[model samples]
Target: MIAALRIPLMSLLAAAVLAGCGPNFAERSKTAEELTDEVIYQDRRRPPSRLRDVLFSRTDPAKVGGVNKYLWNASLEVLNFLPVQSVDPFTGTIVTGYGTPPGTGRAYRATILISDPALDARSLNLALQTRSGPVSVGTQRAVEDAIMTRARQLRDRDSRF
Candidate 1:
């Protein structure tokens, strides 16, 4: 009797542990989709000196709730949706190490040089500085802000996952 009970109890405990490990598959997928949307359809904004804060329902740090507030911070939002491994919000720059074709040389670090904000326009000067030359993300502030607003709504309304 004791041996049989032990087997059943162990199985139950194992089930509970797995259940508490992380969010379910659907939740994980949803989170991934959300992140991608933010990146691909990210707000097209001018370079900002500071990230503006949107009011979101307060969440307890001890609890798994609400959007990642840290991500919403001014600098982070600027570099949130770039095709890069990671970005540093401060100093207004982005570094990417993605490679070209298979036979291409080592991946280059592309720097997106963001300058100060301008009147009636946001300035995002992009300097690939490679064979491709430079590009600009300037004057897309309105689109970027709109997308950011929508993203905030998505997070604030649904607290799950």
Candidate 2:
């Protein structure tokens, strides 16, 4: 009689332990798609949790955030006359303060954005402004052309290496 009771008690204990394992009712009730969406939402909301994530996050192995090295160098070299306010190579932005060109009387400021890794005309954007207002489209085009020409020259020079 004691052996029979022991088996029943052991089975009851095993059932109680197994009941505590696995997902709770709320989690188990969600559909697979909902669960997946919830996971993605949580991941997006979460900030970098590790040092490696902070150091190399949003970086592509094939490029440096789509910035063209030739264009970047050429922009600085061509606009060296203007005082640099800020530069971010990762974002491919150069902001310059107002300064007269070598042969010009009027002061001008320039902001350059290199949006692509290609050394092409479309990859360079130049916003030129003077003390009164933005410069003419012709002037803007001229500066862009100069920067593009210099960028091509730089690329050609680098190829010799």
- List TM-scores for all candidates, in order: 0.24, 0.64
| Candidate 2, 1-161: lDDT as tens digits | 99989999999999989988956876658788668878988655556779999998875432445698888989999999999999998889999999988877999999999998877888888999999999999999999999988888987887788
Question: How high is the CA lDDT of each candidate model?
Answer: 0.45, 0.86
Report how far off residue 140 is in candidate 2 (Å).
Answer: 0.4
Q: What local lDDT score does residue 104 receive in model 2, on the 0 to 100 scale?
A: 74
Evaluate model 2: give its TM-score: 0.64
Query: Largest TM-score belongs to which candidate?
Result: 2
Tens digits of per-residue lDDT for model 1, 1-161 = 99989999999999999998968766535577567767876885333334443334343432222223322332234434434765555444556544342454533234543344221114343333234543245424443454345435545555565
Question: Which residue pairs overlap in candidate 1's backbone?
Answer: 43-144, 44-140, 44-144, 45-141, 51-74
